[model samples]
Target: METVRVNLGSRSYDIALTHGATANLGAFVRAALPKTSSVLVVGDSNSWPHAESIQATLTRAGLRAGSAVVPAGEASKCLERLAGLYDALYELAADRSTAVVAVGGGVIGDLAGFAAATYNRGLPLVMVPTTLLSMVDSSVGGKTGINHPKGKNLIGSFHQPAGVWIDLAFLNTLPAREFISGLAEVVKYGVILDAAFFAYLESNSHAVRTRDPGALLRVVTRSCRLKADVVEQDEYERTGLRAVLNYGHTFAHAFETCGGYGTLLHGEAVSIGMECAAQLARKLGLIGDEFVSRQTKLLDALGLPTAPPTRWPADDLIAVMRRDKKAVGGQMRFILPTRLGEVKLFDDVPEPLVRTVLESAVSR
Candidate 1:
């Protein structure tokens, strides 16, 4: 097992990554949670079957578990769905002391975290992340929310979890596309901070995709450690260190928004967005053609999309980017890669250059 700590002072927590850790979840929660008598297990419909095992584990350990099942997909992460979950929680007779366990992907984590944050003011939120993207990113940082029609994760709050339980066995059931999407986030960890890790991915992409236990464990542990290190230093994203995690998200949000929700998965948008960012970096002379080609090639090899849909107009892409949370005073803030693993924030990025990059990216 690999453990990473997010030191947020009062809200600090630990993220544990292991191949077959689910079996020990009850014991871990009992040791970590102040009161484990009751927990609301929130998961997507697709995750309910596996969640049954988790429910049993919790029950056998003296924890009474109530479950709320939401439809699986991005569309469910909305106010309406949240409202439904709120009703379910009410029917379940949950209280402030009830611990909420989110046992699916990013969508479940975001919704359940938000519910726990708002339920009777607040509850102890426990995360049992079953997806790669959730394990490395969404499950660690306190950032939780559902998407609005206007933008992704627009309506949310920063509610950190009490603990995060990651079990690699769930990856065995993840579809190929979902698995590759998770790798996009894994790559993001490298692109933003660890160049050596990026090189490792470049060399071992195939093995990682094939679900080699050793390779997946190494990648997940490293990614979680890096993210935890940054979040501990800047828990509320007060410092810009945490913002670097959005290296490719500016373009990614635009891609997903324009493409329509469900048309492109978050990871898929990110994969293409990273390519767009790389192109922008090269156009700005921040990096060279060789670097862009290298990143794009590795992304392609992973079976992830490396280009935005050509159907979107450059103007639309630019328009959506302007609405991103990172935008300032009507100017867009971009997370650009200055080198292979070093990303920087650039508020001075000109519109023309941005437009040019978007045109080239979507056209490709």
Candidate 2:
């Protein structure tokens, strides 16, 4: 097992990664939480079996445990589902001493983590990410929240998890498209932070596509370490340092919002968002066509979309971008790559330029 630490001083925690790590979920929970605390295993419908197994393990370990299953989809990450979770905790008589075990994808982690953050002031959160996107990104960060009607992640908090347990076994059951969707974030890490990691991915793309265990370990561990380093520096995103992690998210969130949340998966939108950002960077003379070409080739090889879907209008997409969380005073802000392994946040990006890019991205 490999361990990566998010050093938030008082809120510090470790992300443990290994094959079949879920089998040791009880031990991980025991170490971080008190025996007196009860555990609420919040699972998504697709991952309820794993949740049940975890609940059983926790019960056998002498901790009071209960399980709640949320439907599997982006829609579940909303205020209504959150209220349902609150009701579940209330009926279980859970209190501050209760810990929420999020046993599914990013949606589950965000929803359950938000519940843990708000319930009775706060409760401990244990993230057991069942999806690649959750494992590499959402699960490790203290960022948690349900989606709002206006925007993606507009109603979230910076509540860090008590422990993050990543089991490679979960990937075995993930749909091909879902698995491919996650590579967008993996590619984001390489684009904004690690050129060598990007090259490694390019060379080992086949291994990664096949879900080879060794490649997955390296990918997940390195991705977590890179993100952890950034989170350690900017836990609450107060400083501009953590904004680099949103390399393609500004555009990605816009795509998601314009698609009405359910039309496109988060990572699918991210894949196209990264391409658009790269194109915009090229237009701004920050990088060359070769840079865009290389990134595109890699994304194509990985079976990820590198162009915007035709369903959403370009103008509407730009409007959504203007409302992104990174926007200030209604001005658009973007994390654009200057080159592979580096990016910088640009504010007050001209609306005309953004519109032109969006126009070309969707039409292509």
Candidate 3:
């Protein structure tokens, strides 16, 4: 097992990465919340088996544990499902001393984390991420929320988890498309922060595609460590440091919103979003065509989409972008890449230029 610590003074926690770590979740939960006697295991339908096993383990450990399974997918990240979770927790008689164990991908983590953050003021959150996207991004940040009708992640909070347990074994059952979707975020980390990591991914593409254990360990560990360093510097997005983490998210979120939330997976939108950002950067002369080509090649090799789905309208997508959380004073803000391993927050980009890029991405 490998451990990465998020040093946040009193709020600090550890991300434990290992094969079959979920089997030992009972002990891990006990160590993280020694005073807690009850746990609310929240999982999606696809991940309920793991949640069931976890509940059984906790029961054997003499802890009062109950579980509620929600439908899987992006549509579930809404106010209705969130309310359902609150009701379920109340039925479970969960109190402030209760800990929430989130099992599954980003959707489950965000929904359960939000439930834990708001229930009776707050409750401890333990993340058991089953997808690559959650393991690398959402599970560690403490950013939790349900989506509103208007935008993606429009309603959310920064409530950090007490512990994040990542088990490689979960990926064995992960769908191939979902697995490919996750590589987008992994590529994001390399694009915005580590050129060497990006090169490493390029060289080891075959190993990563095959889910070789050693490559996965390195990819996940490095991704978490990079994100933790950023979170440590700007836990709540006060400084612009954390903004870099949204390298392609501004465009991605808009794509998701325009797609009616279920049209494409989050990471699929992100893969295309990153491509758009790179193209926009090229148009602005922030980077050369070579940079865009390299990114496109890598994404293509990873089986990720680099172009917006033709069905989505570019103008409607731009409207959605205006409501992005990063928008300030009704003006847009984007974390644009200046080059691989580097990016900067660019605000108030002209609407015409934005439309031009969106049109190209959509029409291509």
Clashes of each: 0, 0, 0
Better of 1 and 2 by TM-score: 2
Worst 10 residues of 1 by lDDT: 355-364
Q: What RMSD does model 1 have?
A: 1.2
**What ranking emerges by lDDT with the best candidate at the front?**
3, 2, 1
Tell me the TM-score of each prediction against the true structure. Answer: 0.97, 0.98, 0.98
Cα error, candidate 3, residue 67 (Å) = 0.6
lDDT (C-alpha) at residue 309 in model 3: 73
Per residue, candidate 3 scores C-alpha lDDT tens digits across 1-364 of 8999999998999999989756678888889889889998899999998889888988888789988889998789888999998998899898877889999999999999999999898899999999999999999889999888787787889899999999988888899999989999999999999999999999998899889989999999999999999999999999889999998888898888877787878889999989999988988889999999999999998999988776577678777777788887768888888888999999957888888888888666
Q: Write down the lDDT that model 3 would get.
A: 0.90
lDDT of 1 at 313: 84
Give the TM-score (vs. native) of candidate 2: 0.98
Which pairs clash inside model 3? none
Displacement of the residue 203 alpha carbon in candidate 3, Å: 0.4
